[model samples]
Target: MRKSKLMVFIISVVVMSLLMVWDMPKVFDNINLGLDLQGGFEIVYEVSPLDGKSEIPEMSAVSKSISKRIDVLGVNEPSIMIEGENRIRVQLAGVQDQDQARRILSSTANMSFRDVNDNLLMDATVIKEGGATLAFQNGIPVVSLKIADQDKFYEVTKELATRGEGKNLIVTWLDFEEGVDSYAKEMEKVAKGEEPAYVSAASVREGINGDAVISGNFTDESARELADLINSGSLPVKMNELYSNVVSAELGEGAYEKTMIAGIIGYIAVVIFMIAMYRLPGVISAFMLFIYLWAVLKVYNLMGGVFTLPGIAALVMGAGMTVDANVITFERIKDELYKGRSVKKAFEEGSQMAFSSIFDSQFTTLIAALVMYWLGTGSVKGFATMLMITIVGTLLITVQVVKFLLGLLVSSGWLDNKKTWFGVSAKHLPDVAKGEERKYFGKFHNVDFMAIFKKVSLLPVAILVIAVAMGVFNSVSGNGFLNLGIDFASGTKITVQSDAPLTVDAIEDKFEEFGYQVSRVQLSGDNNEMASVSIKEVIETEDMYELKEALEAEYGYEPSDSVVTPVVGRELVRNALMACAVAWVAMLAYISFRFKFDYAISCIITLMHDVLLILAIYAIFRIEVESTLVAVVLSIIGYSINSSIVTFDRVREILDGKENAKNPKEYYKTVVNEALRNTGERSLITTITTALPLIALIFLGSPSITGFNTSMLVGILAGAFSSLFLAAPIWYTFRVNKKPTQKKQKNVKKLDEPTEINVPGINS
Candidate 1:
């Protein structure tokens, strides 16, 4: 049986290795890249009906029309999604001319016919859906339209024909805005030697017409585009850009490279830490972490998910989560080994005992990830997506695959007596045959966590109070509670890169040259060659074009820009609050179900503490509060509960054994302290592993994600502190202070008789 188990383990390793090597490259190749990663733009437009009385156009039709219009630009893999009742989101990746792309996309291809008097006769309603075709009339390219109504066209032609000489003309106009554009105005511009606004004007020889030919001095490319726009059904609704994020290719490539390097470095550090700390089990988890990543990437690619900067951050966080699970299990096994149990017996009992803690932690985090996905937009949603994938992947790989591999190794009988292989030292092991008491061999085994809980808990509370006071002060002083970024506040942000170092004054002077003053400017990059400029007022579309051109000419590269309207900013703020609230409620309910209400309340308080602490830091430090901060808070809410749950799981196990203790109050405190001492090392190790990659990101990753990494790093430390010192103590207080019912007293008295209780966990 030992030989067979060994052979099965070897075969499984070989199979997994083969699969990973074969599919890794293909998985990366298949995954989609978001605009932030690949360089392009994403815009959400609020659509309104063209005519006031008309109902909003079907979103599907609008999306389809936009898709067809995108094809005219020859873009690859454009994403057009209809959001809500009247908003359409268009994401175009790898488009060079953002200004032109935006213009083409939102252009109302409302073709119209007018008499010489410039009075409208017929609109685009007369044209068929797919009837417009490119043609040549006497060597000049033209757009031929198959009229849907022959009679209306004939009547328009007849009116034009009745007007004599040059006045007997049918004027064709494209994108004629009501109360703004007219054929007479366009002809007046032509007379003044400026370009005509109308597309063409042709003499109407007769009133007989089934089709219409629009002839302007059109180039082949221009004619084809005009025909394509007409053929692609006109947008029945007007589109107004509410939010847009545009990135330059140079910026995208730089961000992707820097973030990837940071991620690889972080992953390497985590793997090394795991192997060194957990010994042989660490090696198994190390190997499994590789499999975990490959599996997550494979699943994400299959789901057609786009990889973003935040998504990469989530992947790193997921690695931390997986490490936490492995550490928890390994710690349990070591505890069992400390009791002088055989390796196989220890592994069996430890795996079973660690199941509840792992499940509760991962599930609570899963709840937060789901809420973020539902309410977050843009990169926040991407972060949530990758987080969800990682959670599911970590749970499956760590719980099932890691256990199975470890099981095979244990069952092979090769590791039967070597407790040290699982990081247990011989000196720490008790002599079970001699009836010695089981001991904790962890580093914090001597520290009474409850003794110092009051002092340490005061720290977070004071910080929270300071944060609130700062918020109130800021509000009174007219500075907002937190510094809001473009994602949560309406503004224009432009990021420009130059070959030469840039200064705030230089950039301000440049903006002044364009007749505008920037609200604020900050320089980054190793040589200060990049500048982020913000404007309180959203720049008009025409002004943005001129600014983009002037900046590109000066910097030798086009600057990336983001414009957010007040409407989108308000919506984003609401959604972020909603995401956080829903995450809290969901985690509270789940923790309550898995444990008890007191445990749930304590965990929730700890989570809120971590979130508020981070917010307070942000408020005091004046960090830009943006959508990414939402991802950070929710992630902390999900993850901070882990240590609390692990400790509480231990408390429950210890309490079950002392259910009928003589002094229930003193025993409750004792159990919590014991649980803390027992689980303290694993919790610290989990945070360290998690922090390793986040630290790398903070120092080495793109400047764009620096805020995200820093916030997460702060939350991680706060979470570990609160879970260790605050949550357990809070739970202890709740349990000891509550009065027990009469039935419980009787039960305690009944079980008071000296008898053994064999609890079904490791310590039991």
Candidate 2:
């Protein structure tokens, strides 16, 4: 025991030291700020052909084109990706001037050369479709254009002439391509009143079909546009801007302040609760919890974790888990007290008894966290990573710091009297008041074990198995293992607020006339005054203007506000999942290395069950799986495993006791029952307490956080259930054999008499 205590001390000190030295504060300081926390431009575009055939593939192409254009615009960390199948959501970070971003994004890069008779000479299509050879030799630009099919060329050229001139005559091109300067120079000569003459040039390309060398004096913009046009062929789809907004950082400031205040209040409340519950021991536990918080923060900072609103919530949740460990330990002390043990003996035995449970619970929560971190994308993964880190920190503080301090207090005679402080009296000690061990904790020897263990409860097992099977079905059925949000798939989101109520069907008809395939249009605002129109394609600037005009024409009033754009795409989704998965797997492997294999296995199983159950619930409810779901899963995983570790620690204690005459099955049952008795109230209370704020968020928070809260509510329930029912039961089945081991037999010595100790307390 001494050696174990010393080992824990050494490990904690080393870990904490390393964390501090790594400058966690600086690391967290550099984390990427989210769009809400930082000022940025958000543009929603509808991508569809003027003909409006849904044009999903065409919309994807337009999104890519626009993204490339934005990239060339040099907006810092531009988030230009496809949303759903129709919209393109573009976010430009650090873009303070919304108008500038809009102008840059909206400016159509259309380039063309027209003849004096208003005939189309060349356009983006001509450059893209034409087999052109480009080379720069001795400072002279040369482009050999080959027109294999002249019939299609004439039709394209005729269409270009009808599109207008002056600003419209500009030739659009991709950036940094070969032969654009040469083409521009040739066009410049024609613009300079040169005679219309056909020049047959075969030196540029020997055996090419029909070749023309375009050379003229061209400006940098014109040349670049020409290059861009050549590189990116004409977009098959036209963009209609459905929505645009430049959300300032100010919106997040209030949320940040509220979160901070709430966190502080929550921290204080948890500490008070802990201290009030267990008196001196509780005080020590509270102190350790504070340290745990500090350590977790430091680690988060050191690891460069960005503290978003969801991240802050995760921190609070982690604090609750930290308090949970103390609750387990204190309850164990109460149990020991009920066993007619001395204060010192109760303290030692309780702490010892609580260790395995705490470890198991935490380990399981960590596993779930890992899965969240594994499968989750974006903010979800971020939350999971932080929660996992804090869980580790909490374990260290609980098992080592809290335990050590409590031991020191008892060893130094600080807690010699049971009725010393905080209104706790001898009556509060369950052991002294009862004068015997409780039925659950009393030693079981020479019992008819076969008779008692004859029947196995298959009901719980059946339910669990069914749940697992359902989860597997969901995984294969394409409802998905995790809910994927619009942030990953490209789509359009149009928020329209009008003075009067409007049905989704009415709005759908208006958009459908404009050739947009409306997917799911739902009325969103209170009093049915606002409508959220989700389309298969992004709505562009022209689309928005037309929609506004149509709305005014139909309802005699335009929408007071509106924003439309595409969702995120596969790339960002892939990255988010990778980040989460890596975090989870790493944590799992780490836990396995740090603890025993059985401990690791229990954690993983509990986590899997929690995740699967959450998925099943979501599937049953038919909630769209999105990024927020990922955050919920991560948070729940941490919470659930934290509970499992607590139970496992208690089981370890019972098994480690001197009077372990029961077989593994009996020992497991005793531990499971004890764990429930010890942590049942704490788990329930903590989960309820933690869930309250989330519930509040669900009712009052913004749309962004609503998803997160919903996920948390479901995940928390699933996590708690799995921790209590699945973690230990599965662990016992796998690790503990049907028969008692030699080590167990040796540990149970048939004592003739009970040992006694004398202290200053009146009871003996």
User: Which one wins on TM-score?
Assistant: 1
Which sections of candidate 2 miss by over 4 Å? 1-33, 36-276, 279-304, 342-345, 352-381, 395-414, 419-425, 428-485, 494-536, 548-603, 656-671, 699-703, 732-764
Model 1 lDDT-worst window of ten: 743-752
lDDT (Cα, tens digit) per residue for candidate 2, span 1-764: 55565565557656655765576456445555555555456667677553435444555567666776666456655666564467676766556556546645664544444433333445545543535445444565554455545555555444544554432232323221232334345456778987322221111112223434445443444334344434444455556675554434433443444444544565566567666766776666666665676677767756755566567558767777777777777766776665666778887887786676677667656765666566654455667788788778877766677777667556655555653342244543455454644444322222332233223334435555665565567789964543444444455555455667777777888778888876555453444555555554556788778877877777675443224332334544565556545655665675567555676677777777677667666655556665445556656666765776665655555556533454655766666566555556666656765665566556655443455567777788777666655666666676555344565444577789996767667655
Candidates' TM-scores? Answer: 0.90, 0.56
> Candidate 1: global Cα-lDDT?
0.82
**Tens digit per residue, CA lDDT, model 1, 1-764:** 99999999999999999999999989878877877677788788999888564787678988888888898888877788665688887888888576778878998888788776777888888888788899988888898888889998888787677878999887888777768877778888889988898888889878957887888878998888888888776677788888887766655666677887897898899889888887899988989998999999999988888787677768877888888999989988988888778788899999999998898888888888898888776666778889989989978876789999999989899898777888777778888888987775678878888889866767877887888888889989987888777667678879899999888899999998887767667656667787778876788989989999999998998787777766766676577678878887888888788778889889888887888899899988888787667667766776787678888889888877456447876788778888988899988898999899889888998776687789899988988888889999999889877776665444344565688778789558
For model 1, the superposed segments whose C-alpha errors exceed 4 Å read 118-120, 123-129, 133-141, 144-159, 175-178, 206-212, 217-221, 375-377, 431-440, 501-530, 539-553, 557-562, 657-664, 742-764
Query: Considering every candidate listed, which one attains the maximal lDDT?
Result: 1
